[model samples]
Target: MNEQPRNPDPEIGDAFYGFVASEPQLTWHDGTPRLYFKAGQEHYEYGPDGSRTKLPTTFHDVVAFRGAAVSGDETLSKLDWFVAHGRLEPNTNPNTGVETKEFIANRLGPDAARMNIEIGTPRRRSQMESPNRRQPARQVVFEPPEQDQPEHEQPTRAM
Candidate 1:
């Protein structure tokens, strides 16, 4: 029999609900594709009397890797609401000797239907570079995979 650990790290397996406060910057770090973004979540406090007070929005530095990073950045835009689940990582700035924290997004994405996001038509590189392009009337919808159903009935969730 396996026994669960009595005390676990509180920050592990944390979930964050917020809007992408900044554009996701994609870059190659040590030959690995990485996407970095800032997300902001509004804070609220509940008192003993059951009254809730709104507080300032707290910003989080988020990092995603490889496919998750690419898909997330491609599908999500700045100010788009998103829900992310991951572990918290703390690091120290080698140059400044200051400690910094970031959330490594294991799973992250935006809900197109809830966010009212319009999917633009695919365009060639030249067309994408041109400023006179017309907007497309396409949209994207997300459906969860039906694992319990037959293989034919399962919906693909790839973006």
Candidate 2:
């Protein structure tokens, strides 16, 4: 089979940070799970005197599929601040033939800028321990591999 080489700097999608404008709905489309929500994105203009003027919030329709749909349904709610990275696709209404854009999110998460978050220590399971009841799957956290540092240099933490 012929395949094309992957682009090193491929275009992913645009990112938007906003508050949830409506309650998220989880539905199934053609046997695939889908999550739908509206995001209210606010804009601001800064004046020369450092004063900021708030602009009207723009509402956008956002959708996520598969694993993202399940996670979003569990964590997202109305009025919650979130960040979504996705591409806009034209969605036309069959009855009206009106074209509208929908944000198809590949990634969705809480906006850290507007909230505080704590990274919990990962729970480890013992080889001998057996669970009496079925446990919910734990969310996996990815940690980058530690890079080798010079003997004279020590790692520092940012405050």
Candidate 3:
């Protein structure tokens, strides 16, 4: 088996912070659950006089698999703001040979503070589609891993 790094620089890993463009779609891919969504980021600038300006919004397709997909299906929506980190992947259409690009999220979640939201249970499909009585929404909150934070701001352990 051969293993090669797709991107040599870890700093260049795929990262995106933006608004979700649509409700996430959850489905099975190769028997592992997957979640897909589109996210849009609008560029802005502050002028010398403090005036704000907007630039064209950039959009990216984001896909989450496994545990990430499970969590996303519950809490993600078009109305939410999101942040994701993964890798840029390129694909070619088999029939036409046209190339397309996508970002597959290894870590993803809503920006609760930016969205002014309190944590709440995600409305999962399983609960919605089940013939039995619906279960109450389960609230879950996540904190970023220590390694993911800036070195200067990393939390310190008590002696």
TM-scores, in order shown? 0.60, 0.65, 0.61
Alpha-carbon lDDT, every model: 0.79, 0.79, 0.79
* lDDT tens digits, residue span 1-159, model 2: 988788667766798788889999999989999999888999999999999999988998899998878877766678878888888899986899988899888887766567443223112122224666678889999999999878896779899
Candidate number with greatest TM-score: 2
Q: Candidate 3's error at 153, in angstroms?
A: 53
Candidate 3 C-alpha lDDT tens digits along 72-140:
777778857877888889967689998888788878887766865445646434335545778789999
Q: lDDT (0-100) at residue 90 of candidate 2?
A: 90
Q: Find the 10 residues in a row with the least total lDDT in model 2.
A: 119-128
**Candidate 3 residue-wise lDDT at 94:** 85
lDDT of 2 at 34: 98
Error of 1 at 70 (Å): 0.6
In angstroms, give how far residue 99 of model 1 lies from its true place.
0.7
Write model 1 residue lDDT over 1-159, tens digit each, in one string: 999889987665888788899998999888888989999989999999999999998988999998878877777778878888787899676899988898898787775445654456322233344556686878999998866756576677998
Q: What's the TM for model 3?
A: 0.61
Superposed model 3: Cα runs more than 4 Å off: 1-12, 93-96, 123-159
lDDT of 1: 0.79
